[model samples]
Target chain A: MTPMTLADAANLHTFVDALRFIGDHPGFLAQKALEQLELSGAALGIAIAVALPLGVVLGHFHRGSGVAIGASIVGRALPSLVLIAAFLTLLGIGFVNNMVALAVLGSGPILTNSYDGVDRVDNEIAESARGMGMTGWQIVRRIELPLAIPLLFTGIRIAAVTIVATAPIAAIAGGGGLGDVIVNQASYRLSGVLGASLCVMALSALVFVALAGIQIGVTPRGLRGTTVVHDHSRKEQQ
Target chain B: MQSHWGDTLQPALVQHIELTAIAVVLGFAIAFPLALLAHRYRKLEHPIGVFSALLYTIPSLALFQLLIPFTGLTWTTVEVALVAYTLVILFPNIVAGLHSAPDEVLEAARGMGLTRMQTLTQVELPLAIPAIVGGLRVAVVSTVAIATIAAFLLPDGLGYPIVLALKEPTPFKTEIYSAGALAISFALLCDLALVALRRALAPWAARGLA
Candidate 1:
């Protein structure tokens, strides 16, 4: 008991015990990671699906970027924990509620980035495409979407980072992940909590690094510099 | 009015705001100078940015849990973590905002015989208000959200109701509603007020939201 207590302390012993915990409960950590990935990946996928086209169209015509901007402001203000709990009372503690919260949160970045990306495309290119008798959709698909791809990916990266960081909180609503190990300190024991937290942190880091690699890989070499700077603005929302 | 366990709403809302305001003000105070230094000495950017990012990357729960051994579930633990989260956002925004002033505008100020410090205070800072205000809004909103988790540590602030309702058999409906709604409201109000404040202070940059 004493050694387990020491191991749970979130210190060097916790780190050592974290390794041991993972080794001992490989199945448990793997399942938790799976839950986390599923939620965030689902949330990110839905957010991009909804926000990307909306942002592109709005940005193309320059009509309602305000929606993206305002949503982000409101979204940043709503704490994920509270939102999840609120949804729990309303929707019952389950996957749907947590998924809804993450999607709402993640939509902000994707929409805003898509809007900014499409709006910033070189108008001259679009005009030339227009002069060549291309219609709005064709011009968009051909010129603007290609140009906006990097920014779109930046948005996804931002949303993915936010979702990964936030997904652990889903434990509160029984939308279980590493948060079970984090919040149920008594049940999992402190070493378990600490070890699970290390797992959550590692999961988030892995998501961030992997997505960043994807962002870089997708972006054209010439556009890479702009993409890097573009990422800093995305951080402002977080 | 009592809603189980003799808890009221006013104090929770007030404390949440107070806690959030203090952390943001203190965070801004510390981050500003660091931003200035980082901006002035280009060499400091990566290291400072990395340090802030490292602090920011610590998961909120892990951070609180890590501090329990030393701080013993105190406000100090909450404040330290809250303040640390703001640095990564604030430092970069301040630097970016300060640099937002056009190079020509800065050179003209220098040509006006304005000392470097005076130009920074007088010319550059005013120009930088938009970015600074943007950063402040993000920090305040995020802090409000994070502050709710403080209930687990001290049973204080809006988080108290939130934590209580979620944990105990109290009719959690009101508690969850009040805490969540108030937090969202606080964030929106603070953000809107900052937008107005930015507009009032820096009218020049009002050209299409700067």
Candidate 2:
């Protein structure tokens, strides 16, 4: 399809028309949104399951920091469209292909943040925990994990937003979502495209806000003040 | 198709670079002054930071489409969104870099009768190069990756082939792999170049003493 001129687009459908299109297809839009949420949620679940343990272990042992941080850099640098295309070739079109690709994409931040969060816990604090004769597992579980909640959630927030944003590409691989509307511009036309984009932006914002709330809720009040100290130390380390 | 792969990819590669370059340059052009302004006025810092972060949170695909009604499917639409993406990274880094020059250094510049502009130009900016270039590297690398999506609107980048292959009746493995590989390599290359730039721009920073 040729690109439309502004006048052509405006004449065809204004943003209001996009909203009306959305309103007209409530069930269809809801299904698309749910598909989007399911795919991203599943991918995020897999990523956290895999990355959290690995990152925390590495961080607890103070090992593989490079791998943790490096993975995130590469992950962030990856283009999601290309990722979906590449996966489609490997796995063929379907939900699995997109799910796996999204999982890999989401894992990076979670891994990096998990490791950094644990690794950055004050040495003196960890030492005191050790001095008190707490087991390694106990220290990691009771001390480091709680302290790392904020950064862990930061990682998750980044991953969730990224996954939600990129989930639209899954439609290209026949994994249905809002992308079905956004990418199928020929069938759905510009109104559906704009409407779906609005849905996606809303979904992403919702995910971010939800994660932020979880981060705050999970963060210990006492440690909240100390995060600043951690921030300062991080700057000094840099 | 095999014989013409080079011809097809060359223009796409050029377009990809052109888009990434323009966006990063324009993003920096806009962000640098905003960073300076935020630095000059403490009150502006929170708002500028919050606004940029909010922009960053908006998905690139959505942002592009959101602009299309007004901007059409032109490169301007893509550039505007891409520039917006860069601000979150660029503004914070530039502000942090500007603050990196210590109070002692600022006082030294002042004590030496250096004017505000002279102090900024000669001392602070020079000191800020590491942080500034660090942020620039991230912005460039991300822009390289994100510009591929612009091909959805404009058939002018590596993303074009990937999009084409995906939309094909039978997906084209060759196109998908080639374009994906090229984009990943391009991002890595840009990152390396920026790392080298940071070294050259602030040689002392490479020494790890600073």
Candidate 3:
């Protein structure tokens, strides 16, 4: 079918009417979008729960970074749909499979970045921490973890955006989300698609802004100054 | 259902290979020039980056649906969307690789009476190859994996099995999961190959001494 055109305004209006009819029924656009938002949050929660500790442990071990990186690469290398399919096969369809696939996908960058952040902490600081007879956990908690917080937060932010944006794919496995609304609109030529897409975009933007605010709020002023100075020095060295 | 493994698996594998190869090649063709343009004009980088970021944010299914009106659910549509997706991964790598070349090295090349084209081709391009290839590796793996999603629109591939598995009456979901496992394994193998290739072509670069 040809794409509905501006000239087909009447048809578009009919489509809008159909969407309104669907909205009046149970489990429509607004409900589906809310369900998706919740699912996205759950998926992100799972990713952070799994990835943060793994990343910290891998960073501590040093040997495990390669393994973690490899895992992340694999996570990224797998298509979202394929992941959905794989999860669906094993777990059957619903929130669980969708959550697993999205969490897996979202975990990679977060894990990688967290590991990198911890690993890239100045060796001197770590050496001093050890020299002071600090326990391994103490060093990680006091020195490495605080220093890595900003970078780790960056990864989490990226993962949040990615999960929220891609959450619609869950609809394919019969997990309701904004994606379902988009698909429904396409199949039925309704106006709900536009509204649903707009909602998704709005949610994504809100998440991004909120994360940025959190990052700024959490960052230490001294570290921020050091980062700026470091950038300047690097530029001068170059 | 076809009982013969080769009848179902081989053709799908071959089709998967062909589709990924074509998409990677074409994606590089477009991404390289765009990267070059963005590198040349710093102002252009923002718009290009934003465009790719937006493209990256677009769900693959939604992107395919958007293209359907223009490309009619054909191989062309699938390939184009795959290429577009690849560009998002590759463009940043290419631009970063080029920019990573030391200013002194570039100045020396110019001092030696090299033209801009010659400097880019001989001096910059050679130096940037490893980084560009790193990006290409990412593109290749990503495109291969995402290519499976094209089965939703395309005629045949590993994704066909996935779709069929969803439709089948049998409880054996292994058929779909196995295909996904194979696809992921194939991606890992290709990634390893790229790593080996990078090591061979640029040992110093690989060793981080470059």
* TM-score of structure candidate 2: 0.93
User: Candidate 2 or 3, higher DockQ?
Assistant: 2
How large is the i-RMS for each model, in angstroms? 3.4, 3.2, 4.3
TM-score of chain B of each: 0.91, 0.94, 0.91
Instruction: Rank the models by DockQ, top first.
Output: 2, 1, 3
Ordered by lDDT, highest first, the candidates read 2, 1, 3
Check candidate 2 and list the clashing pairs. Answer: none
| Top candidate, metric lDDT | 2
lDDT of 1 by residue, B1-210 (tens): 255434567788888888898889889999999989977897898888877765665678777776665566788889888888887788889998987888889889989899988998998888888899889978988999889878766778887777778776433787788778878888888888988988898776543432
Candidate 2, DockQ score (0 to 1): 0.56
Q: In model 3, what are the clashing residue pairs, if there are any?
A: none
For candidate 1, give the lDDT of residue A47: 87
The prediction achieving the highest TM-score against the true structure is: 2
Error of 2 at A146 (Å): 1.5
The deviation in Å at residue B149 for candidate 2 is 0.9
Instruction: Please identify model 3 stretches exceeding 4 Å from their true place.
Output: A1-27, A131-134, A182-213, A222-238, B1-4, B169-171, B208-210
Candidate 3 chain A, which ten residues in sequence have the lowest lDDT sum? A227-236
Model 2 agreement with the true structure over B69-162: per-residue lDDT tens digits: 8788899999998888888889999999998988998999999999999998999899989989888978988898889888778888999988
**Model 2 error, position A31 (Å):** 1.7
Better of 1 and 2 by lDDT: 2
